[model samples]
Target chain A: MRHALILLGVLMAGMGLSVEAGLLGPLGEQVGHLSATLSIFMVGALLLSLALVFAPKRQLGALFKQPRWLLTGGILGPVYVIVLTLATPLVGVGMTMVGILCGQVAASVAIDHFGWLGSEQRKVDGYRIGALAMILAALWLM
Target chain B: MLLPLIFILLLVGGAVLAAQSSINGRLGAKAGVIESSWLTFVIGAVLTFLLMFFFEPAQQATLFSVPKWQLTGALFGVVYMLAIVFAVPRVGTAAATVAVISGQLLMSLLIDHFGWLSNAVRPLDASRYIAMALLIGAIGLIYLSHQQRHRRLASQPS
Candidate 1:
């Protein structure tokens, strides 16, 4: 039950991030180019640094040591944003958002159940599977 | 512009990232979620800068021209990263994602429908509400089933 709550929280956070990104997309478009996007990331890094300075030393060190994982995650961040930015220009916000939602729900199910890419293996059951199907269908219809 | 196509692609990209984040969360949880999140942001920022330097040198100078409003997005990002770390431990990835999405959709509706951002007001119509409802429903179904499976597994334990 606790785990389920955690998963829900992650999903909500992810969703919030997407909406925020969408809001920023217009600004990004106005600014134009990768540099503009990168600047936002730089600010994010700066904020993270500030956070680290206030945190315990041991915690900070532990965070720094996971470089490889961080790198992997880091790569995804830009790629995801760049792709999203490109897509927004190609399609309207509504349709683009729908597509992303569909893809997320589908991929999340697989990641959650099978423990893909070193994730903790959680059981895939009927309801979750059905939900994925429904989301996909919703995306298609939208 | 091509609004529909962009929307579709954004949705797909968003989904991929969502899955990736879930995996990342689980992997990073063992190491400490905050620490992992911080590292991911640092690495992601560095990589983004490198990509910009190589591919979009022409726009580098414009970096300083960034508007103050955009910084709001960065602030939101910080809140998001922290929320992901904190929520993952209590709710699990799927549920956490749902909660975030629910928050976003509600917020987005307000922003778009009310023209809260000073942009053109895109009224919240029935279809948009319907879409949000379906998405929420889908999330609920998945979380409920996940809990059931977990319970069953606990009962069968070694």
Candidate 2:
């Protein structure tokens, strides 16, 4: 039951992203793409900052004590945004998203297989391959 | 040549994105979900600010000049970051990532079909329905695999 809820939560997040893309398209048209991307993070960060103000103080310290390497995760957002900005016009959105989806699934399987970044080791067994095959077929159809 | 390289870079970026989920999820487990999401947004804001300052060419309209409703769309990004941060620690990286991806694909098709949020209406076709079904199947398979793997691990000696 608990797992189902979190899956729903994240799934909704993904759904929200599609809406975001729809909205951002026009915004990007008005402002330059980079500026538009910057606005998203800026606005989001501003909101989170306000939320953090009321958050439990203890977690605030926990945030600072983290290992240096973990901080790199945050950088990926900018990298994704910048790359998409560059790729979208050139390759177009469909191909770009397909590439991203393919990369995500491939890397996810690899990460689980190697137990990288504290994720548990789960080899790319038959079940995982089946799942991957479905995902690829779905992408191809798209 | 440049096109393939850009495409490959996107692929690598996607892979790194999966890794980011695991890493940030672990961070969220240690810290707080809000904290984890906040940290990334802060980093993202600062980095993009600099990038925009340098590279973004001038446009006729600025963010403030845009309709207020458009700005609200950025808030959805926060929702996404928060959800991933909350989910990864609970579901593990691969499961959460796939779940999120399925949701994205599912919604993208819906939005395309309905023309929601001002996007063009692309009516749902046979291919879109098939894609949605496959996505659902894929999500179920990944969830089952994750549960079985964890059950097996739990049964084994530490």
Best by TM-score: 2
Per-residue CA lDDT of model 2 for B72-129, tens digit only, reads 7778889988888888777777778788888889999999898888778999899989
lDDT string, candidate 1, B82-151, tens digits: 7776665445555555556565665666567777666678886777777667767877786787667667
Candidate 1 TM-score over all chains jointly: 0.79
Q: Give the Cα error of residue A135 in candidate 2, in Å.
A: 1.3
What lDDT score goes with residue A101 in model 1? 67
In candidate 1, what are the lDDT values of residues A1-142, reduced to their tens digit? 5655565555556556655565576666665656556666778788877877786753655544654544376677787777766775566566666676666655665666676756566666777666666555544444
Recovery fraction of native interface contacts for candidate 1? 0.59
Q: Per-prediction fnat values?
A: 0.59, 0.80
Q: Please name the candidate that would achieve the greatest DockQ relative to the true structure.
A: 2
Error of 1 at A127 (Å): 2.1
lDDT of 1 at A69: 49
